[model samples]
Target: MRIAVFIKKTTFHKGYGGIETQNKSLCEGLTKRGHEVFVFSPKLELDRNSIVENGVRYIFVSCAFKMDGFFGERNKDNWFTRSAQRFEEEHAKQPFDVVIGQSSAAVGVIKRKWELNIKVVSVAHGTIISEYKTFLNNMVGLREWIKIVSNTGYVLKSFFSRQREYVHGSEKVVAVSNFVKSALVDETFVDAQKVEVIHNGVDGGARPIQAHPNNQPLKLVYIGRLERSKGLQNLLKAISRLNNVTLSVIGDGPYLPQLARLVKSLHLSERLIFVGRVAPEKIPEILSQANVFVYPSLRYEGFPMAVVEAMFCGLPVIASNIGGISDALENGTTGYLVKSGIIADLRDTIREFVNKPDLIRKMGDAAYAKAQREFNLDTMLSKYEKILEDVVK
Candidate 1:
């Protein structure tokens, strides 16, 4: 099958976040399975406009940021219009078997899908509404305020203009979790039947169960994009209240500066270390060094592949029990779940692991077992392929 995948951006840095990681996985996995895949996406300033990695071609189309010049010429050259034009051009040359959209990144294609007589399968990583709420919950600083304001305006404009089209335009919507599925139907009012839940997963090839060193300070790791919605400030505050607990902050983003300031103000500069922008392939090695995986996100999330990968590394998790995060681990079994952004809840949960270190290995074993049974990447890829086949038929 020749697949055309439309994501907002094709550039990948897996350690940064899940969407790109999953997008890369999907494209590469399909290519490895002998499907020809072409990705259409906008390019950033520092990124190459075109590149092919792992047997997939990435076509960078428009600017990633919404930039428009005089007379709205740039608006006419936006992602939506560009992607559609490219799709038609490519389709005419050699017809595509299927079209895949990564969230609203395929908005351009879907907007014209029916007109072009094509099938579009849009993958919902998470809804803008859910993210908007999370951002509003963690609102801080002028930069954050700016984002909130801009995003609110985007939502309002998109809703009346193209939001519904993004949902209904596609033949099917693949929600990353039941949580995300709910958001599409309830929040966005898409019919529930149009959505399918396919959880994000990790490659997690065979590896030995983790072995932890005795007599070490509890090493806790948090992996995700550095952002206020991740609830890192409260996690840091919780860490500050504890003794002999060291943290490894992995990944980077705009929120780094504020998180850094909070780290110093809380006097956790030494213990709460920032590992910074690790590739996803290296994450398990890093996880092996730590005893616990902490994800204190304050609101909705698609299933984070980090959570599954941490479990694969045989580290027990302590994450927010909100959205699809609640689906990732068995409460008090594989790991523990806490109320999002509550410092006391986070502190007590970490303290539980600290006080009962033996539970770490025991829970980690369970986590590894569950991840093996459920969250492997091949399993996800197979399900996706089936969806594509069925959709095409």
Candidate 2:
């Protein structure tokens, strides 16, 4: 089968984010399995608007309209109309059997569907529904916020309207998790039959690391952007309450300095180490080196790829019990789930894990087993393949 995979950005093994990394894996996996794959992403990293990676061709296109209105943050316009035109020019050479758009690339995908007559499958990262109602509340009662706030509403409205159109225009809509499915169905009013849940897969495998082997400090790792919504402050507060647990934070974002100051103010400078950003390929090694992985995000995340990567590395995970995390971690069995934003509960969970070191082994083993059985990369790619096959047939 020939498939056209669409995402907003693409990077090599090093600079890519979760979605990009997953798209890369899916593209590579699909190609290796005898299917032809083409990746359509922004040409931000490319000099010639295209590059071929691992036998699959990547077509980068610019967006005409500024996505700031679409995504609620101002970003450089990507000549999307030009990109769609380029795609049309290329489609004449070789047509794709199916088109798969990840996240909110519905507009571009819809345009592609009109040109190609191929089935379009939208993989929603998370729809703006009841869970995002909080954002709406934040936008109200502010002057000059009218434009951006209106745009935010416009974006959500467009999301629902386009999603409905895409659902009717294409073959299927894949929600990243059941939590996302609920958001689409109840919050967005998407037909349940049109949506399917396909959890993101972890890339590499993780093995249990032996702690206390040579008197090394217990290493705890948190990977991903250092945003307030991700609960880094809560982790710092919880770490200040605990003893002997050293935290190593990988990744950087707007809130890095703020998080650093919080650690200092809490006198946790010695316990918390912020490593800033690192390469994606190095993440597994970092995970293997750590004793536990903490993801205390307070936001309604779709599903964190970091938590799954930690599980694959066999690190005992402690995370917020929100969205699909409960489905991912299997709380008390695979990993510990603390109440969202509860610093005390986070501290208590850390203390429990520290005191009962044996629980780490049990949960780590469970996590590894779960990763091996349920979240294998090949299995995820295959599931996608089956769906595309059905859609095309």
Per-candidate alpha-carbon RMSD to the true structure? 2.6, 3.5
What C-alpha lDDT does candidate 1 achieve relative to the native structure?
0.82
Residues 161-264, model 1: lDDT tens digits: 45567788888889988888987887678889989988886788335344445566888999888977888889999989998799999998878999999998
Worst 10 residues of 1 by lDDT: 64-73
- Tens-place lDDT per residue, model 2, 1-393, is 877777777764235666776777778888999988887776664567677888789887755434444553233354445555566676778887888887655455575576567677888767665345434433434553655666566667656565566555556888878988887787556679988888888666757876543245567889988777788888888888777789999998877888888877999887777887887778888888888899998777787888889989988799998777776888788888999888999999988877777777788888888988888887788889888888888
What ranges in model 2 sit over 4 Å off? 12-16, 68-80, 111-115, 130-151, 211-216
Clashes of 1: 0
Candidate whose TM-score is highest = 1
TM-scores, all candidates, are 0.93, 0.89
> What does the lDDT come to for candidate 2?
0.76
List clashing residue pairs in candidate 1: none
